[model samples]
Target chain A: MTNGKSDLKRLSRGDTENSGGAIWHENFRQAINILRSHKMRSGLLIVGVAIGVTTVLAIVTVMSGLDKRVQQDILSVNKPYLIVSRFDPFAGTKDKRDLMRRKKLTSSDAEAIEDRCPTVDRVDLQVNAEGMMSVLRYGNERTNLIQVMGASHNFGYMFSFSIEKGRFFTKFEQDHKARVIVLGYGPAKDLFPHRGPIGKMIKIGTHRYKVVGTMGSRENIMGSISDNYAIIPYTIYEKDRSSKRDDYQIAITIRDGFTLEKGIEETTALLRKRRGVKPGEENNFYITTSETFKEMLGNITKYIGLVLVVISSIGLMVGGIGVMNIMLISVTERTREVGIRMAVGAKKKDILQQFLIEAVVLTGIGGIMGIILGMFAARGVAMLIHFPYSVPIIWIIIAFVFSSSIGLIFGLYPANKAAGMDPIVALRAE
Target chain B: MLITVKGLKKIYDVGSQRIEAVAGVDLEIGKNEYVSIMGPSGSGKSTLMNILGCLDTPTEGKYYLNGSEVSNLDDDRLAYIRNREIGFVFQTFNLLPRANSLQNVELPLVYAGVSAGKRKRIAMEVLDLVGLVDRAMHRPSELSGGQRQRVAIARALVNNPSIILADEPTGNLDSKTGEELMAVFNKIHESGNTIIMVTHEENVARHSMRILRLRDGKIESDKIIN
Candidate 1:
């Protein structure tokens, strides 16, 4: 009974020790000292972690930038519109030959959709001569080769943009196949650096066409909006610019009170009926929205990102295992010191924290190095490709936290082993 | 009484063999007493000293330090007692190799959660008491064996612990240096502190006011030296 009472009393509180958080400052110094003493081993672990983090950061930055570029291009029309085409525009070039096998959908199909699908508010047709890289020339001044598009009369309204300087062409001009042309800001600025381009006759290919207006500025990067393009009437293009390999695209806006999804459904049904596609068979053409383009870009990026992540994880895994092994060895090497510390009043928790901090400091330094290197790589590529320059601050923060967490995870077993040691046996260790 | 032990026992399992390191030893020590424990190599003197210092618990017995039974205390509380009540001086001096003499002395106070300024001040006081104030910044490897042991002694006294447990404090020092350390110990005892030391040498045992001899895990004799 007396022994039982003593055992019960033994479970009483250890009096809070009155020791504040200030006691562990020496532990931090000790951890730094320990890591410093083994420079080669610590350096190897840091490099390993740095490589993994670098891979993750570089891949994430490139993929995000790619998405940003695709989004900017897909939404440049500035309206919630549908693009009906022969194949998916944003499917990438991986399987071009297969996608090209689909049948073409012409201006006739665009006309039918506008008439049959009441959800369609307005429709515009554009055609690109696949290889028409025409140079625009003025008096002793010439601009680089850029594709010229043949658009309907209401192209400016459909694009939700007005001319920056002059007026858009009229329906009579499109119907009469007039020789008037409008230049995108890029080409307009180049051909008329010192003078106004409007009403000026510029040579496109073998013919002279008068510049009627200049499109407004959008992005400085050479995205869809800022492309150095020249636009002429659809009738003019069909007569003078249409080649055997021309590709036609139909842009449609949904009528008021119609959901985009409902409009798309109606258009798809009508197109299938018009194209004579059999029931239970795939459609002979593609219809995409801006959201659809975004989804396609996301799918491609997700696959590439996953692959890169797995590879970097393998690198980090190897690095983490290396850290754990060296930490175990460190615990063994410092067994006597741990015992002396215990005899001087250190709790098991104190020893565990000491080793854990050492591991984190080592990997934390690696994380910083990796972030710097990855930013350099991303910035270099962005400059080369003319993407918007930005610091991926979120990914940098995530990488740092992730690398520190790796140390915490891998350092646990070794630290627990150190803390669980019997002080007597540790003191007796040589 | 500063310490009391009733039928203390310690058993170790080495593979299938059961070894009784300490069996049925009863002892008492009063405040400010200077005592020495002596025995042959396998006579369990180390095990008994470890039990007395609360470094290891007794398997079957009662241990009271400062009038409270402490043998059944859990590890955290036992660590607290080790920090606040008992100071251990190892045979090898056990000074942390990389730490300077002052930092070594401040170890116990650091664990006690003493603030930085107070820890340094109190550590300096103990270093002065051990006559190592001039060598406070010198690490163990840079100091002589006797100087290193004095640093260890200063560390042991820094927390103002109730008892100092010395395990062959002079074992690594020359005879002259050992005699000097013994004189320091005598001075410490006269200034009202309890000290327990373990050694096999009779001359070293003579330095203490009382001597206890151990044989086969039991107390063979207890002698008082006036």
Candidate 2:
């Protein structure tokens, strides 16, 4: 009876107006209150959705970071340069064996390409120890990161290698077959932590070489294997190994204003004429550009990404099913409330929308938590593996939408059941 | 007539057996009539009340509210009828436990699509009419039994329903609270709103101007107590 007169006076003004907005607001408040009241149950359901979203986002972030790293690695070799190898670097075993049986490319092929090819500006030939692992020794510090490669004096210039300390091997050293090596950044840091690497003696597989220069890192390769190689003059490697059938790789740089296609064509014609290849036969060697290797790496990464998507989709499915089961239980527990709503005249669609919105809101919250968790986890993993850190915005959007849709699809059945209940029977239930 | 039912029957199919909850019941209620239906347990009074309230459909017969045949309407139309024409008051004062009395009273207005400001005004006015304006902000759990019943009555009246149908309105209260509720109902009836209540107690039926005693799903006696 308190404030009775004022209440009646206030109610006299206009009593009829559309209450749809107010009703919707009230329903949402009620749903959130229900979730709050049952904190453990709601938290469990949210964790289910969070786990699914986290799995997908984390895997995608890691894979995307790896893809970017590999692409950068391929691009670091500089442009307008072609790699002519005896075997396709990205090919299967059969093509490699066929190229291996034909004949190992010698230093003569590099010299012929440099002299006769019209578009060629300069060439640097490399000979690597095939399938041989070298253990490097410097006093007491030992490392298995000894990738011993022999190259010409022009190797640093053709590959855009910048010296972090000291200087690259001179042309006189290449002609003299001197045992002078240039350490990559990783080997330089590891082998000479206390002092400068210049004038230091390092052993490569029982052979000794003085460190003349150290090259800084160009790009982060996915694995840390990019900076592990130690380079020496091709004359030194050939004279020491005493091998005639050395499989040599030729790196040709096209002259200014010349296309890579023209360079490849002129090199191909000169090599075929010099080696006496018959007409209508395929070239014995393989030609690869930076773009080709980049595309090939992308394809391989795509397969791995596809497999990861399949695995995460299963996790999402499991999470979606858990959401459905919990929704059903919620409907059963609130049967009396549904009856009360119907008695006051709520239509089937109202009930359906109420539950559907609740489900979406629940999963939406889960999606946000998952994104935060996944990004942090991916950053941690990238740090552990030395891969580049990349933020995948598109994947984040996709994961958010995917998680909410899972709620929409899975929450439909239980919402329908709640809407289809008979008001009389529901009211009669305890 | 505000309500008319002819040869109304409600049959429940329990497995292979059929149970006739309301068997050929005929009744007529005029505007502003204060009527009480008296019956023992299992007398089908509850089923009859459910059918009249539009919460359940009759298996066979005709029911008219304000001269419109509503015997076999669709669920949506029936929901509209329940929201606009009929107001139900359950024995337990079936209020949403989460909502306060004002919000509870505004429920039917919400379904009628009234604006929030108007709903609050009308609900407050109805609460004032029931002399429970102070209790408007109290949830059912916070209010006493008589106060909760007043809130329920306010909810029933807020929408200006054609008929306020109450089943055992005073069944769950102490005798003094029940009589106080009866006094409130007398005042409502005096204000000229039709009301039909079902109760087993004779004293409860004495408050109404007319009484119908039902047994075995049929009317055994009818009388005017003026």
Candidate 3:
């Protein structure tokens, strides 16, 4: 019996007082109240569901954050851009020797694309080779071995960057093949520290190039790559290389009204013409866009995501079974109560609704706990792997709906069993 | 007549055995009549009480209550009839263990879709009638045997049904507590509420105005008692 205040006045006059709420509302209140009272039982009951929802949500959130990072940060420097490499930068089946033997491109090819293709916008040439890594130094402070890349002045502006300090070299400095440089994030941090590195000179190989600016950091998907390189003027690169044509790669931008497809087709046709390829032969080059990289990443992770979802679903199924088992035990345990209720005039549907609501409330609470834990899990992993932390709100809603539906789907049998009881037999149960 | 039964029979199938718990019996009572059914163990008194309470349907027979054919109704309609016309009290005090006395009393109104305010007020009325309004908040586990039965009585009275069917209502109570319970029943009866109780105790039966005795699933005797 509840300890409601014994209002002396209302005791004698049954007054047909205004009782409130629908039958289900009462059921819901009672269910929630009881669950709240017995925390440990409900918590244990919902653990399976919580684990399932956590697995799916954490994995999906981390994966989505990585995917977004790949699209906006790593793959596409500026959205709707293309990269023309001599061979596939990401494909795995390529013969390395054959790729090396393919007709190498030069800075002239990048110039030709900029000059001839109507859809081709500004182009930046990258002329780095496999052994271009070198340790940089200034005032006795040094950096780890980092890639040395050479590109046009606008290269820093277009690729994974914003100028953190000062500015990139101008066209005049690039034309003069001046020894000015824009240090990468790692080099700038190591060589400059508190004292700004802008305008200070740093040694790269044998040359001392004045630091014009520093590039902002970019976090690649795999922690392997980083903004740890030094960018020099392309002309200065040519002046230092033994051969000015070191199989260059061109980064191309599409005109405002044109698509990357248009830019790729135009550049391919123009390059094939310049290289004297016959109409039928494949152009001795590969083109990549944001979409291509996304597809490439998708192909690999698609399997992983599928496996995680299947495992999570299995967890949910197990959780649902646990719920059904508990519900069955509850029905058996409350058989006498069920009989008493029937004697007091509760219908079969009323019993069914009571048990069904109980199941839903259980799973629904588990789902909420899972969502909170999953978000925390996602944050932990995102920070662990250096990915931006984000949770897809839609997936949260889906997880909740999915968990409660597990209740609806699996709770049916036990609820039916409870509702189908013969009041006499039930009342007779000990 | 407020109640009537003709040739009512109930046969239960237990695997390979056919047990006729109630075999071909008939009886009747009018509104506001307080009746006691007396019988030894296995006398079909319990079975007949189940039929009258609408907790179970007879295997064969016609039953009329308040001028309507009760035996022919469907499960849902029977539930409605039970809600509106019949209340039941059991030997074990069958109060929902988790619910308080107030909640137990309000349960019938909840099923009847009465709002919370009216339910509380009406349940309080019944609790006061049983002189346990101050114990409204006590759960079954917290109450003594007498107090628990009093809560059960309040629950039976909450809906103000036409008749209260009690099967050995004090079977689990001490004689002193049982006598106290009979006093409550006498008070309800004096207020013109009809009650039919099944008990093997002759002293308990003495509280009722009329007594019907049963044996071997048949009425052995019917008599009016002081």
Scoring each candidate complex against the real one, what DockQ results? Answer: 0.27, 0.45, 0.44
**Between candidates 2 and 3, the TM-score winner:** 2
What TM-score, to 2 decimal places, does chain A of model 3 have? Answer: 0.83
Candidate 3 on B66-181: residue-level lDDT in tens?
98888878888888778767878889999998999999998888887777787788888789888999999989999999999999988887777779899889999999999999
In model 1, the clashing pairs are none
List candidate 3 stretches off by more than 4 Å: A1-21, A46-56, A86-104, A130-146, A162-169, A176-221, A235-246, A257-286, A294-306, A309-329, A383-385, A406-413, B72-74, B142-144, B190-192, B224-226
TM-score of chain B of each: 0.98, 0.97, 0.97
lDDT per residue as tens, model 1, A19-44: 65646687878878887888898888
Q: What ranking emerges by TM-score with the best candidate at the front?
A: 2, 3, 1
Q: Per-residue lDDT for A382 in model 3?
A: 94
Best by TM-score: 2
List candidate 2 segments past 4 Å from native. A1-23, A73-75, A78-82, A103-124, A133-145, A152-154, A157-162, A170-179, A185-194, A200-210, A216-227, A235-245, A251-280, A309-322, B190-192, B224-226
The digit string of per-residue lDDT tens for model 3 on A151-200 reads: 88668657658788999889899889999988877888888887989889
Quote the lDDT for B17 in model 2.
94
lDDT of 2 by residue, A281-357 (tens): 78877787666767778999988997998899899889889889988998898888888788877878778877877
